[model samples]
Target: MTASTLMIQGTSSGAGKTTLVTALCRILSDEGYKVAPFKSQNMSSYSYVGEKFEISRAQAIQAIAARTEITPMINPILLKPLGNYNSHVFVKGISYGKMHAQDYYKKFALYKGLTESKNSLDHLLQTNDIVILEGAGSPAEINLQQYDIANMKMAEYCKAPVILVTDIDKGGSFASIVGTLTLLEKRHQKFIKGFVINKFRGDVTILYPSYSVLKKKTGKPVFGTIPLIDFDIPDEDSLHSNPKQISWSTKYLNVLDKEINHLSKIVEKNLDMKKIRGLLH
Candidate 1:
């Protein structure tokens, strides 16, 4: 059976896209659905060397969350920045050599890689009950819109419902969400199923007015508000530069259990998963 798909695109990097994807993967796995995670292209310094090739460590962690083996197909193209804005690109777990930013963007590299990414996604859809796609960054970057394989283009290709996630902690969450929606093509806007306010702290009730206004303005429901969870999870780049964050403490373990459980409950209580499921219907 062909799998149902969902794509999560954030307003910015570190908007909690990876964490939410990981949580959703675990939740779906717990519910007995065969779930897999996919990100067409990732630019990260931190990577996982799989059986044959290396992929982003974030995707590797996501696979674990889904109870699956690490595979480079999940992250088809990895761009490891090598300073001076140059990147050593890896395609399908094989090194494709290094190139400067202008050279990489100006050539056929992105398009060529899209073919492999699409093939990998097709393989994933055929093998799983559901595929959760995580886009690299905001879809609103008009400069990169045409060449985008990670955001709305990929969502359209998969016919997946999109969840626009914005980090409220970063402030201007409203403007970010609204501006992003405004910038998307009319057709792309229609693909959005809901908005997710992530990395939030303080009293959510205080923001109820803004939330209502956002829903009214965008004509999309607020999916949920995920609080600022200070649990240790490996982010793609942070995993390498800040190895200290990876350590686990029994003291922190109790906190992690409490926070994760609360986060799951928040997802269950605040987000309309039934509505999300209905998007595929």
Candidate 2:
């Protein structure tokens, strides 16, 4: 049976996309669904080497949350930026050499990137009951829009319903959400199921009055608000220069499991998982 898909996209980079996907993976996995995490392309320095190759450490952690083995199939493209607009690339865990940013996006992204990601995503969809996709960054980047194989393009590929999230702690959550929606192509905008406000620290009900206003302005409801949580999970954004990698030692694995469970509980309580699950259908 073909699997249903739900994607988590953010208004901007570093807006809690990775953590949210991790939370959702555990949430669904706990309910007995065969869940898997997919990200079309990831630019990270930290990765977990599998049997043959390695993938982003964030995806590796997410696989554990789903109770599955971390495989390169989940993250088809891995880029390690080597400075001066150059990045070392890996495809399906094998090194594909390096390319400058200009050539990489202009040529490789169009010719090879799409095909590899499509095949990998197809495999996950066909074998799993559900696939939780995480976007690389905001889909509204006008400069990268044409060559964007990561955000809306990937979301469209799997026909995944998108939940756009923004960090409220950034102080422009409202405008960021509205601006992102405005920038997306009308067709892509229609693919969005709703929005989620992330990193909220203050009273949640204080933000209630604007919920309807947001719905009226953008024609999408605020699915939920995730409070600012001090979670100690391995972070892809912070792991760039991090010397500490995830240890598969049983002792470390147990701690990681507890962190995942803690995060999933908070997300399940605040985020409208019931409504988000409806998007899969």
Using TM-score as the measure, the top candidate is 2
* CA-RMSD of model 1: 3.3
Deviation of model 1 at 98, angstroms: 0.7
Q: Write the per-residue lDDT of candidate 1 for residues 1-281, one digit (tens) a residue.
A: 78999989998887888888888777777778888999998998778786789988778767766777678779988999899989999988899999887777768446777788899899899899889999988899999887788898789889999998888888998999999999999999998888889878888898889889988998898877777776656666633465434324567645654555555555666566777667653
Tens-place lDDT digits, model 2, residues 7-79: 9999988789999999999999999999999998999878888888978888989999999868888999999
lDDT assessment of candidate 2: 0.90
Cα RMSD (angstroms) for every candidate in the order listed? 3.3, 1.4
Global fold similarity of model 2 (TM-score)? 0.97
lDDT against the true structure, per candidate, is: 0.81, 0.90
Q: In candidate 1, residue 228 scores what lDDT?
A: 79
- The list of candidate 2 runs beyond 4 A from truth reads 238-244
Worst lDDT run of 10 residues, candidate 2, spans 237-246
